[model samples]
Target: MKRFLAYIHRLIFILFLVSLNGCKEKKANILPEVSVSNKQKKQVVYQVFTRLFGNTNSNNKPWGTLEENGVGKFNDFTDKALKEIKDLGVTHVWYTGVPHHNVITDYTKYGISNDDPDVVKGRAGSPYAVKDYYNVNPDLAVNIENRLQEFKALVDRTHLAGLQVIIDIVPNHVARNYQSLTNPKGVEDFGASDDKSKVYDVNNNFYYNPKETFKVPVWEPDYSPLGKENHLLEDHEFDENPAKWTGNGSQLSQPHANDWYETVKINYGISPDGKKDFEELPAGFENENYKKHAEFWNDKTVPNSWKKFKDIALYWIAFGVDGFRYDMAEMVPVEFWSYMNSNIKMKNPDAFLMAEVYNPNLYRDYIKKGKIDYLYDKVQLYDTLKHVMQGYGKTDNIPPIQEGLKDIEHHMLHFLENHDEQRIASIEFAGSAEKGKPAMVVSATISTSPTMLYFGQELGESAEEDAGFGKPSRTSIFDYIGVPHLQRWVNDKQFDGGQSTENEKALRDFYKRLLNVTINSSALAGNYQDIHLFNRKNTKNYNDKILSFVRWSADEKLIVVSNFDADTNQKFQLKIPQDIVTSWQLKTGSYLVKDELYDTFSSQFVIKNGEGTIAISLKALESVILKIQKI
Candidate 1:
């Protein structure tokens, strides 16, 4: 009995070896010469928090100061670093926290004043509250006086590495104590000429709180704006007599502690009643491209805030930066995006214009009327996928979400991780970064829109650090601290995985391979057809836990499927219906399909009666991005 068992095991092992060898020959032909109209320049975004990307500090003390934690400087993004980012198939690098914001650090030596502690969130301050539109962050500059020069050099270096640059444009708000000492020639700071007496003026830059003083939120115990210490600013009161509106559009004199009281909101011709004070979009301009949108704005008067932000954008464009990521974009009117983004596109037509609009109702208004290149698909796709990974939502819902956005599918950017969301590896979230693999495969291959990866996402950063005002789970955008998992890859600025564990290295390798394959494939930018419905109805024992789809161009065809069942290995016969087989023009015969990611799995499909089907067994959390070889 023992001899018979050993023989059976050896035979199984031999068969597995043979299957592995067979896939190598099959995948080599995956790079087929398919016809395509597009230049096939797909975008992959790498969002790097400037203050932490190169900070190799393991100190990681909660609410640590710049000196104690050691902040990453602008110069830290070396040629090696940018090259590494580009080699990951990233076309754009979003330099988060590039502009000077309110910080607890005293840059008085650089002639920059200290920000009031009561308003700043963490010791490093919130990046969304822009203090200087015209200047780079002093904390990021090795030499504060030469900060702009350093940033310009970084842009040059990035372009040299063949990657475009993107920086934030926080149009909705500015620091509470807004001042622009670095405002360019012929430029005026926001509210520079506002009549402080009035709360609502069409021309005023900010909404006022007549006769009321701004009250600061009471600080919770153990949470000090200045690391266990109190200052005069934290007196539970502020001095804004006739207080300004908060960043979240709160028009109250004293905003609640939960309110975005750290920053003040900008008034863009929207009144206290939510009525527009500026001109609306011209008739029939809703469906027009930015070229016509810009023309519509010509000779048309806009609010001072619009022109101020426009000039800021144009300054960055001339400074050699390639794009802008608008923060809290929906708070600012869609008309402003039409005005701002239209002007931006007029300057550089290819400038990537992405925004955060969580409301699904406004997705079309932002993308079409606002002339935005992309909007965050968090409310639909990312949210659905996150729930699915946690085993609450069904994969069956993904098809309808895709179908609903079929008209603007290419404008909805997909991401499994970003600064605002919970980390995939956190206990409160997915609990393991490995769970992100199937989701990521779906996100990257789902459409022609861009795919973004947060800095530590590739290496399973838990983001559990008690970093100042911001709590754990999501990586803190507020504090200056080291990202433990990603810092291993940073390895004290070596930018290599020398210190990473085998699992961390493997996860990163998966990300690298998947991103490269995504950008190189013609089918990803081509057409998408949902095979999930057909598979669910026709294939026996198929469950909602599995998702299947097909994407193809003139050059090649790909059948993509993912198993979100974290504990069970699912076995099913993935079917390609007669209609799809005929449309794909898949010839009649047995053809092989290989996994583009990890290359650990492959399968063969035979076309019978104008239908092609393959037997697939997916391990727990396994995803197969099988490229169908031409017969």
Candidate 2:
């Protein structure tokens, strides 16, 4: 027994030495602000691809039409289905691809123009290339004429299920053919009244190239937009007498195939030289919230495109949308967001507004001046976690990331899977959904940020099948296909996971438990203290693969430890420092630390010397969010 104890002691000493050289060499020099008040539970958003969410068709043929593979309709989101989503702890549901985008479905009979096969990315079309602002996709309705009513019914049902609805607002661009056949009686379609002769004008909706005809991209052997329709649009050219700038800001008459070729860029009163020609945000508006910013714009005159989008957003808000997920928000302008988001908030004060922004430098400006509620943390949290999951990144980098964004952790939304990112279970990512458990635990609990989960993330859907327009890794956003795991959960509209395997069901259960805990935990939103460096410098057997942190509030406290290594169990002592124990006002006594995640493991800690020590052995890819109670 003495020899065994000696061996364990030597092992702990080795871990401490390696960590000291690796982690403590550069401890996080900064700390986040603390709120010693009562804690509020955080918000969680669930992103669902509207056209694919309820589709059970497994016939995933590449570039297939809606009839071939089938599409999920608005009616498919039954009350039971939505309740299942709400029960997963989602406060908001981002219904992607709800707007009317160009497609090859030939809705010409319903007065909707037939989109050219040359411009559409896939048979189902790209959602970002929105063709109509006032209409929902006709393909999503049982009767094409009643599409809007169907969508409205969805919104009403969503609210009835106690969930808010968030749809996409692509402000930076529109379809190459900007014709909204079903706009409100007084609403003019984009570019309908503009003078198309001018290249740049404040009133002009798009930048034009006079006398230049728009040419289609030369099709490659591997990719063809006109799949199985070789004879269709054999002319291979769109009849634009004066070609406009491409959606990606390419002024070329004919953009490369890689460009956002299906869409046209919206001119926000910015000249071709990138000079701002519009009214700037009033100085000191940075200190103001959405309500104040809305008041600022009440009497002010803005650019024409700004007014056009504001009206569009107002129309949606009136139509019962709770908020918007602005597509490529940074590409438009900060001032436009300030104007639009403030207006949206004015109508619905509690509306959720999130953006797909990646520039870290513009985060604060967008948050404060632009009136955005949440920004994607892809560059900082998601990217760092991705590298760490792949076994190349150091866990020490996480603290610095949180420190840098300490002031706005609440506004930063974290996620492991989204439509734009590779699936956590994909071979290109961690190769297994089990690998993301620790990452998900840390992501959902590390800070006060709102958490987001893409559909199928919980059930280990790896995007293994190539569903057209893109390769496997990310599920295709521009195709008629069904998600394998999500379809099983849908279970042909029962949504009871009747077809899920035991492993898949358990994976989903983990997500359900984790998310419910996150939305219910007061400590998650109250205070955050990184206890990693202390463990690395002082504790025995705590390595870089293990992360340690503490969250506390007036009534509740939690210590989170996650093991990132997937090969071996992490046996260590999670030591609570003297200052933290006193600061938390934890009384000196014995306590039971219960695992809130799985509720299967726990530890007994004896408090003394102004400190608390709990011995634990976390298994490979295991995590524990402990709830401490005096016993």
Candidate 3:
């Protein structure tokens, strides 16, 4: 009886051990619940000119036609290409030139109207001058009749590859010949129901000059439409009986040659006399959240333009577009943005809304009141960085701009190059792609804001081709030309760097490493302190040409330093402020300091008497991200 009782006890103990192991295994497989704020990854936007991204054509003729300088189709962004893009550490892909614009190509067979060369910016046309709001560009489709479906498929592929899609929403203007053929049943076109006799009305979609006739702008001495190509409609006359206000707010019947002649301004109930026809938001509406602000506009009697834009935005959102890049957002009123963006959030709470608003005074108003996700950090950070890259500005200018916008720093998106800016590798900008390396490091790591990269910027594209309507030093958004550096990386549809030069390959590899670190590091999204100012005052050999800063979170700490000097190799003892040392809770000892970007270098970080210091040796236009942990 005693032996049987002992055996039962041993069996019970073994069962208990098995049950405990099972619980342990279950707990190991379940991920811990992370807070929403802690799960936020730094966004990296890859903005590609859609038509130029896949064109393998090496023939880049000036004023080239679609057949001569081949255009990339929606089918060009194959699964392999998108996967390569995703591998570059991109979260969002801004596909520019996706909407239907007034291209000077004949597509009458597909029920699309031909655009006069006189009214188009180039043979391909300006993407900002949207011609049809309801259709995709026919020039970008494998089959002209299936353009919209092809775009939709591209959107699906982007989503499947774990990236979001962003396209343009030019709210301030439309093509001079604006027309929409596929409006959803009951919607009327702009100006279709307007009373053209009045200069401004509450419901008019445009501002008019009553009985004045419209005339095309005078051509420059050496330039003409399509490089003086003879066309049937190139008679230098358009058929508008009454002139409307030019896109740049010129009230004259004939705008200047530099004006936005291919487009017309969209009126959002703001009259020529500066009186608003729509009801303004209540004074305290700026302090409200999007849901509350949306409720405020639900019952308000808004203008026809407001409803039209709201419908247009919601349509895209429903069509699986992740967000919009609003062109010239500041040109529109803040109240209109509040109304438009609020409705957008109601449809998709995660829709990313970035805009181009260069005025610093209006940044907060656009962000807090307008509910814009991001505004171009151009006038402040970008301009400062440009001057520094050109060898005139100091690193000290960066901290003040950062301090000024500290309250809303996350909403300021940073970039070294974009479609509107000069390429970093261009002779007019930095003169060499290697010169941009340190600047890009600082731009990507200096803030918790998102970073944007132009398509060929990674491969050191100089934009040296003077493609007809577009000049040198800037990639042509107006012309259908293949980018040389980008095509090499495309490598004849293999989507590999097979044809890239060794220097170009090295540059791209550096970009891949930097961007991956930017997205994965938690310290980058945390607290920041500028050690550049402190080091400049304390450390010997530390000059204004080098910038250093510290970023830290609970789990990680980083010291980022960059030498912007193009001719001198810098060696200095970079110091961290005593306050930061205390904040990081470092005891007087040595810590392991290793470079997170490149593994070729090693150093030691020592703490003594509540101060931290590290030896830094950086070559010209070189940067290092040293991560430290207790030894």
Candidate 4:
């Protein structure tokens, strides 16, 4: 009897040990709750056309000279100006047209060569046609000789004001006459050592039409170089022996009038027969991080063009520039990006690298393999939202896109108006600035992606000027012109909107509130679930014009709804599904719902039977962000 009792005791002790081990494994599998404040911060980019942002001149003449239009200087970005931008909740300032592009204005006195009028876009040339890779735009400086210093000062000032700086890097092409007077030691020009006798060489920087001499494009009847201004270099002739391929991949000796004739394409060792001359990335390289990618290229030899671009990017990174916006990135090879962007990350891991990749099919490849941080979400989100805004499409179309891009949603950058797109207030677009409010809300808060706001977008700047070489509807990036609405907000260097109209002021206030809320909202950086489909099926009087979604974190919960109806006021019951209610762990009770954007209104979110519902009314072109909290 004593032996049997001892055996039972031993068996019970082993069972206790087993249960303890099971508890340990269970605890190990549980994920720790992260606070909302601890989540990643969403980026808000404010893209400003540097030359036009602070220009107070309202004299927007067609093809106006620099002296006539009065360009904005680096000194124009005053402390007050930067503070106002920061107050608008902008994380980074993209200073477009900062590079030394080919311009009609002669800097020959400063040893800069004169750009032929036929090759330049306007008095202030297209920023994409970069003339000098190693210098800043001479026109943007108060003192031309000290332009680089002025830019450095502006960068430092911007940093002092707690904002990062971003600039353009036109990698796929260079100005028709590419020169780099300020290149650092031992650095050579792009095509200095290229064997011009050959049409395609692995080491050549540019692809040449060996026997074909370059000829200028046939001018259209209405358009001429510099708008037919009687400039000294407007002879309608450009000399290029062994003419290179046009920027848009036109193989003709003289490209079409509509082609990117002002710039020449850079060759990346890809043969004319569509075969790669350089080493290809091994399979499964797409899953590797930038560090591993960088290491892979450490001992490898790349094409000459790749090295030149990489050097230029690193030079800018060393010069205190925080990021780059690559123009026409998809035009270049993805392998080049993998090399360039990986090197950039190795230098500054936090560098904001965004590109203009319009092809949705190549989005993931560019992002994961190329190490690119963001691509313009123009074709999908922007087009759909624009259609909804124009009254031709329904909000129902948005959910499928969001669902489709769930894997790479954060890599997609959202914008309503850019330098390339028409203004929201333009007649060709929505015809009223108020129409952008709902779209703006949806664009900013729909995903965890970075939100970009054009400089004059807040103040309802209708691109109404017929600037030289630039027509109405889209703001002129190719000419020296002042933005009227932006100038009003400038208020003569005060950087205060004293000269703005009442409507403009209210519109700006709307943007201000929306942006500030976006950057600080932890819920926006967390998980997103679409309630639009559920609300459409369950709620009363909820139409396709009204869009709804839910976003939440460990601490905060948000229900965002926007009304696209320009003429109708909407009052409806917005419902949250039972699954989401259960996920949120909210018991049956009335919770206080407050609008984070506008504080004047508040509503109650009642949760009953594992479902949440709220009654809300939104006016025409209006939106609301309802925050739920336990009362």
Candidate 5:
């Protein structure tokens, strides 16, 4: 009996041990291989301004047809450029301004509007000034569906080369001379005026003066605000006004009246009478003339133009884009986006929707309330770049940048540059192009956001001009050949031209390394829990220079230290917690070294108790990343 009892006890103990081992293994696997959904994974986005990037083998001048200007053909972009981008291993390609329009001519061809003087002297109008949201720019392709299919083929090729595709969607206004002005699809769906009562008012039917109307102004601002209404007047005032102006005046007419900005207003509402109704909530319409324009957002059933928005959304996805970048999200209704999001997910969940939201205050709300999948993190990009270019200063309050990373899985679409903002390099370099390249590269890469690169960013097109309304002005940096020109100059000169020549190569490599780390390391892909800030006290001395932090998951850990200072080297030590000390490897640049390994660094370095501190001999405005891992 005693022997039998002993045998039973031994069997029970063995079972208990096996169960414990299984649980441990499950936990380990869970932490190491969290399935990164389409939304969660890091994306390398390449922005393309369609007209600027095509093969242009056809006899199209800058101002010619979309086919001539480089829209439909996938092979228009340079092989070298594509090779470099493919080499960089970009995950997605976002083409801006591919949608077609007849009313909105490319800038280079527009009969120069004197009123909107900021319109580039030799311009191709921006894609944002949409003639029709559903159609591709005829200049870009023939039939809308065909154009999209051709574009999708490019995306497939991109995928063949290992990348995805995202396109732009303008949720706001349509082109100045859209065919729908008289007979809108949504209005037709809502049952247009059976009485055939079309009221023609100079103020409502046509473009208007800026002072009287709220239509987003196209004319050069007569007076510019300096901080707070400090005005900067234009050198020459435009004679042609859009309000009183008629189609007979020119192909693209401005409202002749000087009272308001002339652009077709969107009507989000309808009266029971089947007449148009618009809404500007806080400010009701005082003038009968402006009431028709007010018909844009007045329909209660629609809720801020949502009903019509659904059709537009359907049109694009049907056109075949994997994702969309929603323009000016804050101004639009949040419920509309939320509704659209649910519908889009129902139809195609993988579709990406990135919102243009500037304020950090709205980040959480947009995600929670608006159902926005991704938003640009301007503050993070700005502060980090400032630190790298200038040095640490009191201006660097990193709380927002830090707080932003907390729920980044849903809230963050990391970006250094996009269409609406200044070029990342321009911000870092400012007037001296020489100093900008290296600092911009290092700061942009190490910030560690799901990076978005605007068109021409890789080669070096500075965001130097004012992105005026409608015009593809100088402020925009979608110039495709700009980089090629730089490449040519560099090859011809055989010199970095007194700039940090390595900046470009370093940036390219940094991106490659960062992406490899993101795709390969389970640590970066998992939840960014256990975040700690360390050795950042001397912010004033370094001003914009030094930033260091630690991010870890159950399976891995990393200590990222960066020097934003352009002039001096930053040295800092970390008192790592004893629990996480022993199993760590040091990664410098792209190379990984075991803590036990010894080597000479041009700068100083040491590790103790698994706590490694670095004294970097940084070059002018360079960024260094120390990737620590536990075995």
Candidate 6:
């Protein structure tokens, strides 16, 4: 009997070995592919301003031609930037402003040119002033196709290095001088007789009384001047009074006098005349003129403006690009995105899409509908940076920040500084090395969604005080522009163009550590958990100086605390379940855990009974991550 039993056991062991070998063979045959499902994955995006970060072998003149500029070929990006980003192991690269936009100067008085481009007006123009939506700007690229192709090749390289590439697109308006789309008689322009449906009289009143439509110039809501001094308000007419047009032939006649910006408003059943309340037309389309225009693009026979956009989308996707950072997405109809989304995904799914709209109220509907993938978390970012830099703790104003960091179902675009904002480097902060920055960086990266960092941010680039108020303050990323320290570091024989400033280095390290932790953490990676505010009413604790939160899943947990306060130290305690104490690993700045720890007392203990309280000491302006793992 014993002999028979031993024979059976031997047979079972042989079977197990065969199965193991078969598994290995299967693993070798299959290639790894990105997840196609909507699994909650964390992504790290590195934003680049292609104009900067030059090649070492070429002439390194400041902002010169493509050759003299040192970037080599247009598609051929400098190895310096690529190598640095590749080494960091980021997920994607968002190249901001590669398109050409009209450059307009506004020197109006009373305009707050003190802030960055997004806030104040009456200054330099934005990349939003797109001259051509389909063409790449030659100023930024060497061989147009080569530059773009090479960039795509770089994307391939990045993917081989485990990263994606996303380019920016301006959908709202084009350059005032972009004749391709703006020329009154251009093939793409909306002509009164040529594309009747594309142009429409805002209200039904136009049909009942043709005189009203003919007499009134579209009265858009203009806030540019306070009266007339603000060129942006007057020129853009983003929001004007009467909110509707009074007459077509009226003196205000859509205010065509403003030449600094081009691109006229489209009447998509909204308002062109600005006289009456605008409402949607009936099913068959009550207005024949607008219908005629929509047909231009909607028509299967003609390749209209919308078709041009679709072709552009297809072109980039084929170029191996991963996504788009749409400029002025709010102004473009959601229907346009819905159509593009369906068609583009057929070619490349998981393509990251980020819109520039900062308002959730306006964008939430489309986002929920999946018309867009993400949007800039400008509102929360601005609040957090301002509060933290001021040495203030988390206040009531920061719940949106916490909510953004915790919620995962809908992702919010995160960034400390972009081409549009004031540089965070310009702000001074008080705190311990580990406390303040770690919290902010961790929150930005490990919170609810993916985040991005502008080109010079890692090197601490500051913009001019009276910088192009609304226009991009075109600066090169060669390290020497205004930041001497960064230039010195990059010029050092050992400088690989990847090291961080003393403060930025610490922040970068913290971000890397946080990323590793996030990557390894399933709970934090997807939409499996929720964030709970620990001490909400602790206004004193909620000082604009500090931020804190707890993230948890059914079987996992983590606590993040940060003190944006630059001057004062604060102490806090985090609660832990009895079982977590035994398996917890404290993840700190760029550090990883290699070994396991054990406690023999009990598999679990009672926290309320003095068993699982972890004391936290946060220095002025510092951040920490307490990671509790479950086995």
Top of the candidates by lDDT: 4
Order of models, best lDDT first: 4, 3, 2, 1, 6, 5
- Alpha-carbon RMSD, candidate 4: 13.2
lDDT for 415 in candidate 3 is: 96
lDDT at position 148, candidate 4:
100
Q: Give the lowest summed-lDDT range of ten residues in model 2.
A: 1-10
TM-scores, each model vs. reference? 0.93, 0.94, 0.94, 0.94, 0.64, 0.64
Model 6 stretches astray by more than 4 angstroms: 1-39, 55-80, 100-125, 143-152, 179-304, 400-409, 427-439, 464-504, 527-533, 536-544, 553-556, 576-606, 610-612, 629-631
Backbone N/Cα/C clashes per model: 1, 0, 0, 1, 62, 52
lDDT (C-alpha, whole model) for all candidates: 0.84, 0.85, 0.86, 0.87, 0.44, 0.45
- Residue 276 lDDT in candidate 2: 89
Across 1-631, the per-residue lDDT of candidate 1 in tens digits comes to 2123334444543343344443322211122233566577468999999999989888988888889888899888998888888988898999999998988887888889878888888888889888989998888999889999999999999999999999999998999888888888899988888887899888888989777788887666665667776765665656787799998877778786677888888989988878998889977788798889999889898988899999999999999999999986877888999999999899999899898877666789999899888998876788779888888977866776776677888899899988887899999999999999899999999887899999999999999988877789988888889899988888878888879999999999889998998888889987888788778778996798889888889877888999998899999888887877777777788988988886878899889989888999999898889987666
Q: In candidate 2, what are the lDDT values of residues 1-631, reduced to their tens digit?
A: 2123334444543343344444455534324335544335788899999999888898998877788888999999999999999999898999999999988787878888888878888778899999998899888999999999999999999999999999999999999997887778787888877788888888788999988899888778766674556636645778776898998888999888888889999999898877888778878989988888888888877778998899999999999999899877778889989899899888999888999777666789999999898998777788778878988877877876676678888899899998888998999999999989999999999988899999999999999877777669999888898799999888988999999999999999999999999988888887887788888888888888988888877677799999999898999878887777877777788889899988998898767889889998899999999988743
Residues 448-502, model 4: lDDT tens digits: 8999999999999999999988999999998989899988889999989999999
Task: For residue 437, give model 4's deviation from the true position in Å.
Answer: 0.4
Cα TM-score of candidate 6 = 0.64
Tens-digit per-residue lDDT, 544-587, candidate 3: 89998877777778899999999999998888778887777888
Instruction: Give candidate 5 misplaced runs (Cα > 4 Å).
Output: 1-40, 55-74, 78-83, 101-122, 142-149, 180-263, 269-304, 379-384, 387-396, 408-410, 425-449, 463-507, 527-533, 538-544, 572-617
3 or 4, greater by lDDT:
4
The C-alpha RMSD in Å for every predicted model, in order, reads: 10.2, 7.4, 15.6, 13.2, 16.1, 17.0
